[model samples]
Target: MNFKYVSYLWDEAKAKSLGNNQVDLLIYRSNLLGADLRLTNYGGGNTSCKTTEKHPLTNEPTEVMWVKGSGGDLGTLKKSGLAALYMDRLLDLKKIYRGLQYEDEMVELFNHCIYDLNSKAPSIDTPLHAFLPFKHIDHLHPDAVIAIAASKDGKAINQELFEGKLGWVDWQRPGFDLGLKLADCLAQNPDIKGIILGQHGLFTWGDEAYSSYLNTLEVIEKASEYLASNEGKRRPVFGGVKIQALEKEQRLTQASKLAPILRGLCSSYQQMVGHFTDDERVLQFVNSNDLDKLAPLGTSCPDHFLRTKIRPLVLELAPDEDITDYKKIKEKLIPAFEEYRKGYTAYYEQCKHPNSPKIRDTNPVVILWKGVGMFTFAKDKQTARVASEFYINAINVMRGAEAISEYISLALQEAFNIEYWLLEEAKLQRMPKEKPLSRKVALITGSAGGIGKAIAKKFVQEGACVVLCDNDADRLKGAEEEFEKTYGKDSFSSNVVDVTDNQSIAKLYQTACLAFGGVDIIVNSAGISISRTIEETKESEWDLMYDILVKGQFLISQQGVEILRKQGLGGDIVNIVSKNALVSGPNNAGYGSAKAAQLHLSRLLAAELGKDKIRVNSVNPDAVIADSKIWAGAWAEGRAKAYGVTVEELPKFYASRTLLNEIILPEDIANGVFACVGGLLNKSTGNVINVDGGLAAAFVR
Candidate 1:
């Protein structure tokens, strides 16, 4: 809760902006507050500053409030992310506003108050910030503050803790009405430094940005200290025999078995990626004896309702039974999800208004599996990660609140109002157009490096939930970290699997099914290259080549077909063959024979699985030496000797050999893979599309 405001960072921001003090200071302070997870999570808080800017065409000075716009995280917020709304226009709405009847209309009026036409829509809470009289305002749902704000006796306790420095506003859904109520409270108590919104969040403001940010820190710190002092005395303790902690290996094994089943049930009809976490804190909370009492008490704050529903769906488990048993896990997960869905439907019916938007999908955003930790579902990785973080924070807040008194969240009606509010729903409607492969789950083998990694990256960009499989565990871990950073932790996951083994291939498919419901596309990209003549090729060399290049494709594609059949959805399987499959090169009998066999296997599978609507295709790529693990050691030396060139000159020689004289890169191969999987050739399968930069020998007939 300590203020981390650095003067040099603020000075540097102002210097970089050429003396736009308001915006630079706002950005600096927003980042400082956002950097602390205790204060606010990613995109959970907002900061605003009042400034005057001249109208572009009219050249008249107009007062504007630059508030944090929707979809921008305060942690990395920039000037452009703060939408400029005409302060006078927003204030004018208050005069004409009637009662709380026209919530949707009020949101529209706020949108119309924008001073800068090109800026994104202002945050839904813009009116709340505007209604305040301070020049700078900060709002955050800090855990410590929410702990005090969400207690059963929150008002009385806050009155005592904060004294006269803070005012309390009863839980009111965010809208024009709530803004007016907040404004009235502040007006009545002009000496109050901040206001605590019951079951929502905390708001602090000052004439300057630093003061507002620091005031928030100060208030939250005080609340945190209050909770610390009352913890042992007031915290509720449940009496039950403590469950023995499972070994790490045992826990992971059980989780791996149940993760897919839970994932499949949650994503039944919808496309969602489930991010699993077994962190010690999550395990401690889920395994607590008091979980049945505390887990379903509701979200820590209203804002979190948008990410995690009002209540998490907690699955029951037997204490002494084996949790890793698939049948046992499946039996518990399926019925639990069904019951949770029915409950959500009933809850929606009870709380929804006549004009409210259609109910959201019944799938729970946060799932508390019996023996497993938490599993958060989202359309993408970053969102899932954000939800997981928020839920973890909520757990802490609820624990703290229980320490003081009973934890009490807003009533169900208020939660529904926030969840289905026009402003909140608009965020989803405002998302950019989805790509062709959006929400589809894709499994890519050999994803540790080379063309497989490139394919994984492309699928992620197209909005596919990707599963990366490789035999090299270390490389797979590295790829997972790299992709998680680039695409998001939810977008792709890495699994170690030897594609040559049937069991390994089956496990890979199961991982994909659990991680992202089921697979929509499978790219068999794992292979090895051996340049040896028929006379010189040893039996071991030949067998190894066939095991990886030919048999591996057969195993993975077969398993993928089974998963697709179960889902009753047509899918695509693209094999990464090579130009050597069609046009045999000198001293490449071992490699060429295996690839040629793989190409034929793809055609055979296509002919058989097409009845199930499973399309099979192959991309024959040539000499993609860059980052190719297959092109190292003996393969590199042999290829250079075959071309009568040095190792360094091999790439140039291969490029010159092509009719287009182009050097094929891994991304070029990935493009061909995307073409096959993205429905470009939906009706045409059992085809080999050459990605060899126009090699006539490798052209399809």
Candidate 2:
């Protein structure tokens, strides 16, 4: 039971809680093993159990296999996510089996074996689980185990460590043929608990769930111990660090600046969101003397290479260059990135089969910068983050393999075959279409209040990350809590920002840059309302309203344009003006005048920024009384008195006056802004969208 590298986390009480339900026990065991990154990368491993089930027709017992379904993570596998196949039906497929070249066709045959009518689709590894003669099995991509499997003398290393307690199979891409070879290996060596897949991963099994889980951990632990004693405490790895890493804060600052440039370059074909990491291991690899030699050799594990792409683009520098110099990095990165695309294009041309999927975006998924860390870009944040994670797993595998013997990677042709496999392409083709704001990020002032909060929610639902800004610290904190509760934590970042203050606005943009690389949409929604005749209105009141209503838009737009220009990605600026901007109303001098000015400013920005490919538009919302911070105070009484109605009668009064007899809510205003900035208006700028239930007097001419 001695453990060093990976922890043993099987709780007896927890396992016993599942009782006699073997399927529940299977899930419990799978989650425990998948808990550690050392055991498996996210969505990179499989687990299964074979149990007796009622035959659908006979009401008699039949053996069935429950394997983790295709495209699911082991740690989060649910009953619905498990692919259930009748074991007899799956085994019967060998009757019609052709040779290895016909293996992919086996996937089509797998559908016929489904034990449950609505079972999740089986993974290619379904055969790996089905053909093995064990009740419970775990197939994992543990870095320690893959390290040995990916070593120069991997088979001999298994013999050295397991001493023939485990079987060995040379690298064959997982499919029906590899599954058959696994069964043959187990039959030849009946005493072995599992098989080591050359340059791939490990498979271990037992008759019971916990036992199989323990056996999987046992094998990985021993491999980890062997590497630790020999390499963990020994000489420096990757030929020792060559370029020393910058101090923590400096590297992060550099990363903040570099991510947007990379994001911009990669977004030529499609928009991209980015994730950054500076893990100690990543730093060691990027700064190592052997990085240039080892990195381009590519990753060995399919799980690793598939997410990270075959290899990474490593940033180069002369010994005299300072890694912290952002100016120098900005100049060099584009050419280096271009060379990677050319290399990738040539790789595709060299290895593509007739039916191969057309070469994709060609941009590198994982980028390695010496003395910095790693940056990965993808269509969404989670994918980008996961890509970064998979590369770290690749780094670990290389480290472990190099520790005991020379590390080995997949052959380029073989890697190409797996990466561009038509089956894999079909999965990509099956993905849902991108949401309108899929890769966009927005920054909103007054986001803690009614219309602004609603707009932030709508943007997130449409797949945009948002930065929620408000000047009121308490309200912003409360709004942040609501946002986290409503949309999980990663949907947005929040900061206390005063739009009227230029210095405050500058720091807000920095927060946006640090949190999400940069912003794509800027919404000016902060406002205060007052209903006063010229005699009652103070000079200070007019200045305050303009500062918040008009100048807030101006300041936020000015700061946000800097980021948008830096990204070279055209963006959106939505000004939330008011119907009062168009309608002449009594006792509304200051509020009306400022909104009119705001509307004009939107048109002016649109005309000015069109050359920059930035679109500017305004949404005019009328009588937005419900849940409005402005309406909750004296503004409500003032407006109600102007209409000769009590504050209590205001909602009905406003509704009756609108042409459609409908009262506007915060969400309605949010929709108007969306209509202006969403792809529907991609070619239109300097436009006004009215969400006021048809206010004739407020209509834009």
Best by TM-score: 2
Measured against the true structure, the TM-scores of the candidates, in listed sequence, are 0.87, 0.94
User: Whose lDDT is greatest here?
Assistant: 2
Compute the lDDT of residue 482 as modeled in candidate 1. 92
Clashing pairs in 1: 260-514, 381-490
Q: What is the lDDT of candidate 2?
A: 0.87
Q: Rate the local accuracy (lDDT) of all candidates.
A: 0.80, 0.87
Clashes found in each candidate (C-alpha, N, C closer than 3 A) = 2, 0
Model 1 earns a TM-score of 0.87
**Residue pairs with clashing backbones, model 2:** none
Looking at candidate 2, the ten consecutive residues that score lowest on lDDT are 318-327
Predicted candidate 2, C-alpha RMSD: 2.6
lDDT for 357 in candidate 1 is: 84
Per-residue error for 174 in candidate 1, Å, reads 0.9
Worst 10 residues of 1 by lDDT: 1-10
lDDT tens digits by residue: candidate 2, 1-701: 66787878888998888897888988888888778889998898899999999998999999999999999887777888899999999999999999898989999999999999878889999999999989999999988888999999888989979989999999989899999999999999999988999989999999999889889988998998888777744457888978888888778767766667777777878888777888998999999988998998999999888888998988774423443444456577779878989999999999999999989989988988788888888877778788888899889889989888889899989999999998999888988988888999888888897999999999999989899999889998988999889886768888898889998887787667666767799999998999998889999999999999888889899978767876788999999998999999999999999999999999999999998899999999988887688899999999988889999999899899888999889999988888877799899999999998888888888
